[model samples]
Target: MRSQVITGGPFTGRHMLIVIVAFFAVVIGVNVTMAVLASTSWSGLVVENTYVASQEFNGKAAAMRAMASSGISGDLLLRRDVIQYDIHNRDGSPAVVDDVTLTFRRPVGDREDFALALTKTSEGHFEAKHRIEGGDWIVETVSRRDGVTVMHEARRIDTAEFGQ
Candidate 1:
């Protein structure tokens, strides 16, 4: 017996329709999932007002430059039960500052963000008794002398275990 030639292998208009619908369904499903995750994870707000931030950019840049030229720097320490920062001069000696304030923020979100006012422990060493959660952090430190801002520093750090 001779084999009969097939007109349609199996794919039909119905199959084509299903295939197109399934492809789009998958794409739309993935897009919705991604959008939800993104919206929940981060607010995506860098500044409250872009225009205001832009207006002050130049002055902030100048202040930062002046701070850098002054050769003043600070070191931050995160321990299990305390947070510490030490300021130094260009000559490596302790730089005396009136106040040291720290703002700890998450890399992506502001839910767990907090600020601490460090008490001067010694000449240039400031300490704050706050156990920061262990994770990635962006720490902003501001050192002031007689109500004048001396140094402004922002740094990223990862901690294995803090306040544990």
Candidate 2:
């Protein structure tokens, strides 16, 4: 019987080249997608004037401290489609304000940022109807009396913590 010689089975040079190209194609595609997403997500500017903001940081901190010392505080509750806000005074009484503005900013991108005006329900309780998606968010509450802002508070909240 004559022995048969195997030239090529499945490991040809062309097949190797195809596998390498496919691997690199996937890597390059993922890298490009990530780069585009990161670039568009952030504006790369935290403040318009860093030096000016830094200089005024102390004053801002002092103001915030004073607001807190005066027993001015706020509680924010995130429900399904509504946000409940309650402001309190030094005596644990409801702090009545003319208007309240709630700003919801996405931690990752500004595309999901939104603002809503809260309607006063009672003495110090305000409610705003807004649909908040499940994610991390930066909530900014601005309380104004007589059209002048009295208290400004910002905090980060995770939707998962609230059973979103």
Candidate 3:
């Protein structure tokens, strides 16, 4: 164990300085190379596959308007089993919803929450099933397509008690 100890020598400090310099040199070299690579034109390689990107955005916008115009009541429906929400999109439009996150907020006590994971059922529809005991809940949804939400303060509707 004692033989394994590295005793300092006259060249130790100089060697360390040399090693540090070498490390910095290598790092600078790598950065320069990366900069050159990044600046180089890969325009020839860029495939113009976005023939309908703008159209998709427009389609999403139309879908949102349609949802609002349709008689879909906005409320948080409680689920013991999985409940599916049907997303109806307008004609010549795509689903505006990029992601729909449902948060179950406890009503009475200090604010506690369980995240509901939504899976796409069809073209525009998404579903999330959560097992929860009977309690008042505030569900929060993040509609990705629309920047501002039409509704806040999620209404918790009981599955057995009420019919929508």
Candidate 4:
């Protein structure tokens, strides 16, 4: 048998260049993917003006606490065809308010948000004849009497819960 010497090729500069390019390509690809997902998923905007919201936070909190302490609460009923709300005091009597506003808002965005003024159907009961899209929503109930907010409440609801 003849003795033979077989040698493998060296790691050349081309190989180094290929490795660097591949690494950077992967990094850039992942970064772009993450950027697109983040942008489409959430706007990261909780409020239009954070400064003003912060300034009013304390007063809002106080009002909410006062409303809670007053033993007045509200219940919202929503459907695709109509919206209903009932307000009651601690003693289970109907709470009275001059005006009732229902704000329907998306949990993540405001594009589908809308406010509706409900008519008083009876004592402590309000209703509006409007069709709302069925989905996840954050509903804010604001009941006011004589231009002053008497009860304010917010709740997360799925329209499916009410057979919408």
User: CA shift at 125, candidate 1, in angstroms?
Assistant: 0.7
Best TM-score among the predictions, by candidate number: 1
lDDT of each: 0.92, 0.89, 0.57, 0.90
TM-score of each prediction: 0.87, 0.77, 0.41, 0.77
Candidate 2 residue pairs in clash (backbone atoms < 3 Å): none
- The predicted structure with the larger lDDT, 1 or 3, is 1
TM-score rank, highest first?
Answer: 1, 4, 2, 3
Model 1 gets an lDDT of 0.92
Q: Write the per-residue lDDT of candidate 3 for residues 1-164, one digit (tens) a residue.
A: 35686766567778999999999999999999987776662333222456666657787677667656753333344445765554434453435455566777665443355777578665556777666655455566654545555322345644345342
Task: Please rank every candidate by lDDT, starting with the best.
Answer: 1, 4, 2, 3
lDDT of 2 by residue, 5-112 (tens): 988576888999999999999999999999998899986777899999999999999988987777788989888888899998978899979898999988777888
User: How many pairs collide in each candidate, listed in order?
Assistant: 0, 0, 0, 0
Worst 10 residues of 4 by lDDT: 37-46
With a 3 Å backbone cut-off (N, CA, C), the pairs that clash in candidate 1 are none
Runs in model 4 lying further than 4 Å from the true structure: 1-23
lDDT winner, 2 or 3: 2
In candidate 3, residue 33 scores what lDDT? 94
Better of 2 and 4 by TM-score: 4
